[model samples]
Target: MSESFNWHKAVTKKWDQNVAFWSEKSRSMWNEGSRSGIIPFVKRYVPVGSQMADIGCGDGYGAFLLSEAGYDVTGVDISPKMIEHANQISGDRLIFKQGDLAELPFEQHTYDGLMAINSLEWTEDPKHALDELYRVLKPGGRLCIAVLGPTAGPRQNSYRRLYGEDVICNTMMPWEFEQLASETGWRTLDGYGVFKEGVKEDVSHMPKPLQQALTFLWVFMLEKQ
Candidate 1:
């Protein structure tokens, strides 16, 4: 982290500028693309009608999916524009709020589960972000999270930091993120790799390490301990 850099400002600015693009693609993503599996995956552990908080919920599509799947949902994002776009869609069981991951605006033990897709890396402090997630969930609450793999193209946001530039994204690899989550008091219940279309293979028979090594993204199911 840079001492004088404004991380929150830069992150919000970046997402605000892309709200239109995100809104255009979010529906397909949650319905039939890379995120299609998340709702079902979470459903396996978090029962229907449970309260869920969707962190980094861009354009609210993922949160909509959660609501449609029968979970009462609240979607939160750092970018006001993203929240605005998310708010355009209304659901009896869903709502949107603008809030940062490191300091979510919610009471302790407020939710039964939380979902955060590609959000943790956007924070400057992964541990602190994880702690906040822990604080808001009830004991034994489920957490369904996804982190970009080592080769994911979206990780370019952190590339400029090598030359002394201040960047909002963190280059935390899948395994490293798992370790961090473990150290931060989350117990892993299950995890699997999500590869790009052409990269999918029968890696289920392989070792867990090898499976995640070839992923475009790794999704984990954890419980607050």
Candidate 2:
């Protein structure tokens, strides 16, 4: 079944269907929701006024935030509808384009930094996606990524793969991704977890494995070597 499944097409169609609702809440998400801290995190490592790309940039609101924060931002999403909505936003330094993660539509060494919030997991091949991301960044450029944690609801996208089905979601754990990044030439600069609301624990002081186990999302700031 996996051999015959077009995971890329399916994933794009799924996001296309969700464009309306996703675009509607995208701004709130970037401003003061679960995504509020992501741009700030990228800002911490990526210098202001840098050229950056936002992968899986739904509706491009997050890209807008990056531009507002002083970066020249380009938003890329696999879904055409998402790009259409993204194009509606007016910005002198923001660009929106429809493209795939596994095969990004840009020249090599083109960006100073990149952000891929909750984006890598949905790729048909996260490794290829990561490679493409690397290909686009100048040497020593920063990359900020947010991967859904073990208990994230979005993990359900890959659950059916247990039954020999194909899925866009790759079951890549936070620690596993860290290893992959290291092997692929990314130097981890910082790492942290974003937990769900309500319960609180000082996961920061705990081991990386323990912190990742209880997070809703695991964010990493890495440098391309």
Per-candidate Cα RMSD to the true structure, in Å, reads 1.1, 1.2
Candidate 2 lands at a TM-score of 0.96
lDDT of the structure predicted as candidate 1: 0.91
Best by lDDT: 1
Against the true structure, what is each candidate's TM-score?
0.96, 0.96
Off by over 4 Å in 2: none
What lDDT score belongs to each candidate, Candidate 1 first? Answer: 0.91, 0.88
Off by over 4 Å in 1: none
Per-residue alpha-carbon lDDT of model 2 for 120-140, expressed as tens digits? Answer: 988877888899999999999
Q: How close is candidate 1 to the true structure, as a TM-score?
A: 0.96
**Which candidate's TM-score is highest?**
1
